[model samples]
Target: MTKKRNMWNILLASPFILAVLTCFIVNFALDRQFSWSLLTAASCLYAYLMLYTLIFGGKHRILFTYLVLAILLIPFLYIIEYTANLYLPQPIYWTTRLGIPVSLAWLAALAVTALLKTLTHANGFLTTGYFILAFYAAERCTNNRIDAFIGPNDSWSLSDHYPILYFSAAALFLLLGLITTAVKRSRSRA
Candidate 1:
């Protein structure tokens, strides 16, 4: 059983690592100024993971659901980024762009949900709370460095988007958790 679980973990993590490598390769090869490669790689990774989860049946259904939710959320985040670019007085830095609020939120959410799923095997509000706390800590630690590189206005304003994104991601994961639990309960009765 332990070996089986380890194999599952490797299977689940493989696509993510591949996606990261894809981004690196694209970044190095294209030498593009924009970081679109990362986004593209992430999209591809999410899609691959979803397919893998749906076909193989694993503990990653919740994570896959969050990935799907994050993909759905990209448009909304792009809207915000576009709108903010238009309304804000200064030119928006690409790095600090507020385009995908939910995507960022989803990252925080996913991290929290993964942590909870690992530690307690529970998917409750506490998971969300941990996500929020972790996000806050991360924001605090990174804010200064980000501001220094992106400019103070860009750093301060865009930073707020992270927590929101994290929460949105967490919500998706939580929803998936609930659904998975329901399915398991039903199957057990049968």
Candidate 2:
């Protein structure tokens, strides 16, 4: 019975994992980059964990399980460093060990998932959106210097001059996440 149920869970969750994995793979072929892919994979992983827990059934005590899954993926970042020439190790290593660590961000995401078990409301959207935005912001802010092209020869590449866009996005998502949390709280009460 247990084995059969596990199979059912895997079968249900396989499509989401495959789609996110495909997106990560295709970003390399189409854009020649994995920075965006890394962000997507991390976001998808968070949602996957939530969905997996929901299907297999974990309640109140699954936070650490989800957190372990998040930590395991830190090593996964090495793949991006190799393929995209992004200097990921130093930032992640230093930040993870010496400071707050990326795992905390994932923990927050999972906590939100646990709080809002159903993904059919604004809370659900906010929870997934928060994870996506937070993970992306973490990646973007840690090593934000990029040589992005805006037009033919009109490039916006310098890190010094291009802090605005990334910062604004991060700030906006954070504010949204907070507002969502407040709204979710009020809804739960009523």
Candidate 3:
């Protein structure tokens, strides 16, 4: 059975490997170098790993998937930055400064989602609400970091109006989650 499963895994992985190889061959043929193809290979590898984890990760599939994502994300971004630097004419070296922080922000969102799931032990609605809120925070962090990277705009006011919209959406979702949880609890009691 294990042999069969391993064979199936190899069969599934074949397409991904083929695609990456094809990308590399075509890229090298066209450009006489392997710049963007490296990114393609890295992305394909990450996708395959995620798919494999979700399909065969056992009981803690989601948590394991998150772990896989966290471990691979840095290397993936490095590939992206390297590809971008090589492909672009200008020497754009923002992997350490911009990419890492943005990735960290997203990772923080994932951590919040995992924490909420473990702590609440309630329906998905509350967890989703928390996830959405965490996403908003992550986006906000990304925006701030980008602004700083792109040179602070002294002309424009620091107070951006976008946060209000995100905050309102988060608030609505939290309210809905609270109502749903309350109704579910009451129903269970009755």
- For model 2, the superposed segments whose C-alpha errors exceed 4 Å read 57-190
lDDT tens readout by residue for model 1, 123-174: 5554665665566555654565455555777434434766666666757766
Provide TM-scores for the models.
0.32, 0.34, 0.87
Ranking by lDDT: 3, 1, 2
lDDT of each residue in 89-118, candidate 2, tens digit only: 443333334223444545555565555545
lDDT of each: 0.61, 0.57, 0.84
Query: Candidate 1 or 3, higher lDDT?
Result: 3
Regions of model 1 farther than 4 Å from truth? 1-46, 54-57, 60-109, 121-123, 153-190
Which should have the higher lDDT, number 1 or number 2?
1
**For model 2, how big is the CA root-mean-square deviation?**
11.3
Candidate achieving the largest lDDT: 3
Q: lDDT, candidate 2, residue 54?
A: 55
**Lowest-scoring 10 consecutive residues by lDDT in candidate 3?**
154-163
lDDT (Cα, 0-100) at 23 in candidate 1: 77
Q: Report the number of the highest-TM-score candidate.
A: 3
Model 2 TM-score relative to the real fold: 0.34
